[model samples]
Target: MVHNFNSGPSVLPKEVFEEASRAVLDFNGTGLSILEIGHRTSLFQAVIDEAIQTTRELMKLDSDHEVLFLHGGASTQFFQIPMNLLAEGSTAAYLDCGTWGKKAIKEAKLYGNVEVVASSKDRNYTYIPKGYNIPSNATYFHYTTNNTIEGTQMHSIPETSVPLVADMSSDILSYEMDFNRFALIYAGAQKNMGAAGVNLVVVKKDILGKAGRPLPTMMDYREHIANGSLLNTPPVFAIYVAMLTLRWLKQQGGVSVIEKINDRKAQLLYDTLDSLPVFHPTVAKEDRSKMNVVWVMDDPDLEKEFLAICKDNGMVGIKGHRSVGGFRASLYNALPLESVELLTSLMKEFALKKLNRICLRLFLSRHCGLLLSLPAR
Candidate 1:
């Protein structure tokens, strides 16, 4: 019973895992396993269709959008997006918040000029940068919706005339938002969605064929839109698992209900961190991420001991990213609230034990000094 809190490839609903497992053995009464079936057959075609349809349904997207399940992870889109939309001589604006945002900027620079409209690097990305100017002449305005490593999130969308592009790899589907606002949104299927190796892309159909340079067929968004994401052999297994997870989300009453549960789970852990004297949350209260809650202890020794206690309690992947050394509790849609409660209880217990040890030390020291001053024993 591992309480998984890993950042990516994170926890998923038990039902999703069970159903996907059954499909691997036998899919919809078909004689062949999902792994062994031909991808072009109607069986797998239905899987891809339903996955796309369910994604749009959950987000309430309209027919103007095209959904794609591509082979590469979200990183590939970092380059593919700029190639498709960014003209050679034009500039694109980006809000640089964390490591991923910086990575996206770097990739976009290779295709065209990139303007960093705003950045939180000065404060080590503790909060999302705001009140920045978006260049009017920029081809598009790009931003990462959630900073997984820094545990800060952009609560509101940035308003601008330019097309909005987002890399929502970590926080998509965890909460409800205006999916129609963005000209494009892409995510790796490992976090709030499902397994790795597949990237889900949603693009406004009209935005295609705008780049200055001609793109190869594979790199072109128009080609993917025309081919139904079957331009090549897709990551069949990963897409199937993602579809199952989407089904589970719909059964759990869609993103609206799931957002409430995620908010409750995040508040449980964050409130516990705030109440405990020794522990402190890393990000500012208003900008903290609902998907990943990060915190650290006052004493390094206590932090180590606390981690040991967490390991003993069947907790896994609670360790923070190396770049930012502190604990990160990822509260994805599938992570049950009980897991957060267990972690918060451990934090209270650990803080109390440390406080009691300090008080006992003070008591012993005072009494021993008094006795020594009065008479030798």
Candidate 2:
């Protein structure tokens, strides 16, 4: 009965968890655990191969792209992408949408020149920056499709003739997207894919080895691609969980069908938040995120009380990030609409209770003639 809304290491489909549990004990009746089996075995090789194909199928990517399950998170790609693509004199363009975008830009600066096309930092990244100019000769334009920490998302990615790379760690497969538009797409599997152990790299086959640096075998994307994502022992259990998630996604009608559900879930929460008088949404109205809904109450104490009430009502992960200090309900792809409706109801109840308490205290203090009022705090 738990409603999972945590940002990362988020909720998964019930079916995925069930299927994964069975595989761990006896994989394909091999009598050996999926955990103990050698990565070079045909069984494990099928795992990596099918997982990549499922990912491509879900994204509707063509043969122009190569998918690999690398070990490092998307953060590694932030620096590695620039190092591999940008030569000594080359520049890269970045849109400063949120924390991750900013990090990618900073990492790129160490390698070569970087152009910040646009930034939402002036507004605390509450809105997406648009209509920025990309450098004519930049190696690539890097942007984060969804900002996990800030509860913001760029629904329409920026357009660029240069190679485009997206940090889709928090939004990969959450909705239907033109995967072919980007030269590279990377995601850490924690948020929407499966878990935190694996990172997905969907690269354009023609874009690698452009850098003249002496790159090691492991650092090079081509090496991992050639090895089929098992240059060494891969993350055994995480890949299988991702495979299960991909399978579950297919059963639920793939990305296009799931995109509609995601949009509906976001709308349900957003509509409720907009109507409530006590809670205020921080992100700009036009830039509302479909993946994560961030809101805060009029009073900090009230926010705390509301979170406690949500937990009491079997709603978990409703607490806000400590840095932002409000509330963030991440409605990832797998989150059911019932969870959104339940949260909206709780929000209404919390607002009503606060107002009732205030009115009752006011009436009591007013009616007592010359009586000192005691603060509830």
lDDT of 1 by residue, 287-306 (tens): 99999888877667777888
Q: RMSD for each model, in Å, please?
A: 3.1, 1.9
TM-score of 2: 0.95
**Candidate number achieving the greatest TM-score relative to the actual structure:** 1
**Where's the lowest-lDDT run of ten residues in candidate 2?**
368-377
Clashing pairs in 1: none
Off by over 4 Å in 2: 360-377
Clashing pairs in 2: none
Worst 10 residues of 1 by lDDT: 368-377
lDDT of 1 at 26: 93
Which lDDT tens digits does candidate 2 get at residues 220-268?
Answer: 8888888889898889888888888888888899988989999899998
Best by lDDT: 1
